[model samples]
Target: MGEPNTILHAVRVSLRMSQDELAQAIREDGREHGEPNYCAKRNVQRWESGDVRMPRKIYIRSLERVTGLPIEALGFATPVFGTRAAAQAPANGQESARGEVVEMGATSAPGGAVPMTKHNDHGTLSGIWLSRYEYHSSGRGADFTGEHFVVVIQHRNKLTVRSLPEASSNPDSPLTMDLTVDGNVVTGSWREETAGDGYYAGAVYHGALQLLLEPTGRKMTGKWVGFGKDFDVNTGPWELTFKDASTSKAAMDRYNHRP
Candidate 1:
């Protein structure tokens, strides 16, 4: 094909996703943006092969949301005309300047958009948070507490949380929460993969979650209902508290060392 979009290919590889996976992610992102996209693996193949230098406007925006990178940074050439640039810019009051999509109410620095932290009071759900949950285990004969370091990211009205491993050698149980926000209520679903050698024998569990966000926006208290190892319905308390506004080395170390 053309010169081979190495940058696009490298990003997909870095994400540990195959062509089909990337396509699916882009499609989901597009749907969230109110632009339904039927992206297929063949489309991704064409993009990586440089056969399609620039995708449609919806696909470009979806790629930006999925990768958190500007289109130009992803090896797409910038539009020369102002009208085209304006059309491709982020909608709903978000702006694109110098190929950077600036979040609403976010100030631009000399080089890039200012990093939105908890101090900004922008009501953003992006940062590191401490997640604590309780579950009753019949085998243990009592309730047990489990905690993890999670990274939260907010895109529009959606919030996604993923558990971070405490250490390279000792990985955390894989957990993911996807929630939608409406005023003070947060409703979502959670899925977790247990450790293979654990008591449950690596079973996968998932369920619904409903939480209430405090007025301060720093904490969320909720309840989760899921099926237990014995196939019985179980409900438990779950809480997420703001820990760090940034995932710096120090913040990660502090959480990692928690007993």
Candidate 2:
């Protein structure tokens, strides 16, 4: 609605980060660099809700102190007070939610699908970073556990797959992934090169998963499918969850570093 506030909102959303995670990241930065922490979780919430305006100096210092990112990386906030057309504009045919028409990169896919470039604002797709669950079919047919991570990549609605791995239930044998999210869909692959012992042969494993995400009334939901080759095991599923990249990233990070 006013100077600075709108900018903060854009930065948060663009980062695909929760207010709490962002706050934690900022706190970690302060502790790492020996700077006084600027805001707590509640403060971030208030800012997101437009409850208060943090000082400009604090904002700049926080960015530098936390992410070590350049100030210019955060763009100018478009004033919230604008006509529907003006508000929806996003500079390249990108339609703002408020009805302003901006120039957005052309998407071959209909209905506002643009290719996802990176996992974060940093513009580098490291991999799937987190995992929420692992599903297994019960001995009884047609029974399954909760949803799990499915990574998919696409170019103009055409499906392309990377790889898929099961979420590790045992601390001993863990699963992780690196993912690519292009717009509403995500694509990436991972493998557990070496198993603990030769008993299973761990064998060469590879697979791919894909997800299609849509915003529900208040939340986002996605449909997913997966196909995989695990040593002598091969399985495919037509259903899965559409998890955010952050979740995948965290999972992969843990899997890769697990002993």
Candidate 3:
């Protein structure tokens, strides 16, 4: 908490990013953490100027995420000195030999919820989510495998979705979404449009999906529900795993090139 976090300021300058830009990046970087923590430019200013004695631990964590730097090296190691990782205890009367109580909803800040671990949904969310869904309808069932790229508008909490076509999945279908992200949980609705005739045509469904932002922010567990023109709803469980370079370029390229 000393020296005005010179390291943070230096990193910002080295990256040629203004405080506003850095604040926005940090905010967006945290959206996957369930109701993302917000940090304003004024907060950044306070941190840079040492106007605030200590930056919030969450802010430091977010800064590390955005700058790809380490919090300890940033001269703000006090809050994290004794931090420990959180682990889930086996249920049904199962107990560790040490008999430590496991609290499932531990938080991020000091003395808050359990300590953060990898995949606690504290990472970036603007990437490709490769999802596999197994759905069941009245008398039929199906498995769907596809890729979806959600391009997030930084600091706005809004995103546009584009899904790759595979096995009867909609092609060139674009979805507009408004999501409410709470810590480790994301619940949202999307409006889907299509060109066709009859009940299954022309923006037939405004679907909803509830997802948990897992530790790595890459592995997501959720359910997507949609009501069709006939009013019958199909329910499914899905797994959305994050994709990296070689696997995710298509959607991003399309997103960037759109006119």
Candidate 4:
């Protein structure tokens, strides 16, 4: 029973491996050195519990040979290896200091031996959610006076549909069109219909809402044509800001600038 043996057992338990597994691994490692009988489950347990002392060289080498981990990493018994003091020392000095320190349960960093960071989702137009917007002209003598809304497109039936929300003046038959992003083309028409003489009337509408990505999410941008029985409308360019539950500004900047 010795300090080295006790530490070795602690390392084995931390790794969640049983004594038999470690013993077999050790036996396999010993074969490389023509000392094939060096490991057994019983022997490993006695060595780990400090019931017996391990040959220093065999003990150190067996760590890597048995567990496929580096010798320095098996210094799991110490908790000060990850401290700022350890980082300032030379490599060999750091290893020595780490090895000498007794197990204090704080040697390992908060992120284990390796660093792990979580990914943020934002700025990408993940096809998991939907978004929409509307545009209203704000000038006199403007060709378009009524409010024109742009619905962020949702994929459906091999087509992308972008529509304007129905206005109180006229609910059904709102401005809308189908767009194909891959080809950069839009196909559809604006048709005006009359409901009752007072609340609704036949107005002209044209202009396909183009897709655009904004700081928010996928947005639609386009112009309004006219408000008559017969009007000619055309497609306009708009950016659809990609939006998702996890989209972020930093992510968007990186995505747009990536090579």
Winning model by TM-score: 1
lDDT of 4 by residue, 50-74 (tens): 3333223455576677643455434
Q: For model 3, how does the per-residue alpha-carbon lDDT over 34-79 read when each residue is reduced to its tens digit? A: 4376678987776665444345556667878776456654433233
Q: Which lDDT values do the candidates have, in the order given?
A: 0.67, 0.39, 0.50, 0.38
TM-score, one value per model: 0.53, 0.28, 0.40, 0.26
Could you tell me how far off, in angstroms, the CA of residue 177 lies in candidate 1 after the best superposition?
Answer: 0.5
Model 3's alpha-carbon lDDT is 0.50
Candidate 2's clash total is 40
In angstroms, give how far residue 236 of model 2 lies from its true place. 3.2
Candidate order (TM-score): 1, 3, 2, 4
Candidate 3 TM-score to native: 0.40
**Which regions of candidate 1 deviate over 4 angstroms?**
1-122, 167-171, 248-259
* Residue range 1-259, candidate 1, lDDT tens digits: 3335555664554344679999999999988879988888987887776555567677788998886556865654333324766666543222233222332222322123343232323378777787888898898799777677776766455576766655212244666677778778889988777778877677788999999999898999999999987789999999989977875545555665333
* Residue 191, candidate 4: C-alpha displacement in angstroms: 5.0
Question: Clash number for every model?
Answer: 0, 40, 13, 23
Candidate 2 per-residue lDDT over residues 17-133, each given as its tens digit: 567888878767666767646556765654444333222344446765553234433323223324778544343322233423333223422222343334422232222322333
